[model samples]
Target: MISYVKGPLVDIFEDTVIIEAGYIGLEIHVPLSVLDRLPGIGMETILYTYFQVREDGMCLYGFLNRQDLRMFKQLISVSGIGPKGALGVLSAMTPDDLRVAIISGDAKAISRAPGIGVKTAQRVILDLKDKIDMADVLPAQFAAAEGPEISAGGVAKEAIEALVALGYSQTEANRAVGKVEVSDDMTSEDVLKASLKHLAFL
Candidate 1:
C-alpha cells in the first residue's frame, strides 16, 4: 500500500492535487479542507494517503495529516458511507470537530456535510461513538496531560465556543483549544485567552 506521497505539488484542481514524485505525476483526490491548506504549486508537499482498489478501478485519497486519514478510514467503514461521502464529511468539518459532534451526539452538525442527511449523520454517530475517544483525537499535548482537572467542567468546550463566537471557524477554535494546558481551577475565560494567544502566533 502507498502510505504517503511526498514531492513537489504540480497541480491543484477543484478536489484533487498532482504531485510530481520520482518523475511521475501522481494524481490524488483530497478533501476540500486539505485542498484549501495546500501550499503553492511547485512547493514540496506530503500527504498521507489511502489507496483503494475496486472491481472497476483504483483510486487514491489523500489527507493533510494522519488524524484526517485515520478518520476517513473509520468513516468509510460505516455501512452506507463511501469514499466520496467520507470526503464530503471531512470537507465540511475538521476531524476534531467531527469527533466532538459524534461524541456529543450532534447529528445536525454532521448533516451539514454536502451529501450527508440527518439519518446518515446519526448512523455515523451511533456506529462510531464508542470507537472514538477524545484522547485519541486530541493533539499529543492535550491527550497526554488530560487529567480529571482538564477534562472536567467543560472548560475546553466553552473555550471552543467562545473562539467560534469570535468569528473563528469551529475547526480553528477546536485546534487552538486542543493545544492549551488547563487545570481544574481555570475558567473558560482563561482557556480562551490562552487559545487566543496561540491563534495569534498561527
Candidate 2:
C-alpha cells in the first residue's frame, strides 16, 4: 500500500535511486526512462511506487508518474512477465507506444527490449491488448484540450518519429523529448535537437 516515496534524491545508479526520507534512506529500483526526469542530487522529488512480495523476498519499483506505475502493474499482470521484465518493457518504450504496438500486433517493436523475445512480446500483447483502448494512449486532459495541449503533443510526437528514424527506441525518444523544455515558439526540429543532446548523455 506504499503508494509513493518523496525526499531529496541522494544518489542515482544505472537503474536505481536512493532517496533520503524521514531520516532513513530508501533504495528504489527504477526504470532507465526515469533517469531524465530525476532532479539533481539533494533536490526533492517524488516517485510513485509498487511494492512486490514473493516467497523469496520483497522489492519496491518506482516511477516518475502514476501513469507509468499503472502501466507497470498492467505489464506484470501478463503471463510470463515479472516485475523486472515489465520494467524492461517500459524502459524500451513508453506505455503509449507499447499500447499502440500491442494493439497493432507489432511484436517486432516490443521485442526490442533487453531480455524480451518475440514470443514473450506476443504473449504480452495477447494478454493485455483486450484490456487497453486506443483512446487510452492519449492523456485524458489533453484529449479534449483544443489549443496548447494539442500543439505540444503534436510537437513531441513529431520529434519522437524523427528520433525513431534515427534508430532510437520509442522510449528513449519520448523521454528525450519530454526532458526538453520547449516553449511555444520551438518547432519539432528544435525539440529534436534538444532531445538529441539528452540522448547523448544516455
Best by lDDT: 1
lDDT of each: 0.82, 0.79
In model 2, residue pairs whose N, Cα or C atoms come closer than 3 Å (at least 3 residues apart or on different chains), thus clashing, are none
Residue-level lDDT of model 1, residues 35-136, one tens digit each, is 889999989999999999999999899998887898999999998999989999998988877876776567888999998999999999899977875555
* Root-mean-square deviation of every model: 7.7, 10.1
lDDT of 2 by residue, 69-182 (tens): 888988899888899998888888877678667755678888998899999988987888777643355344433332444376687777687677656899998898899997
Lowest-sum lDDT 10-residue window in model 1: 139-148
Off by over 4 Å in 2: 133-136, 139-142, 145-202
Model 1 residue 177 CA deviation (Å) reads 16
Cα error, candidate 1, residue 167 (Å): 9.2
Backbone clash tally (model 1)? 0
Q: Please estimate how well model 1 matches the true structure, expressed as its whole-model Cα lDDT.
A: 0.82
Candidate 2 yields a Cα-based lDDT of 0.79
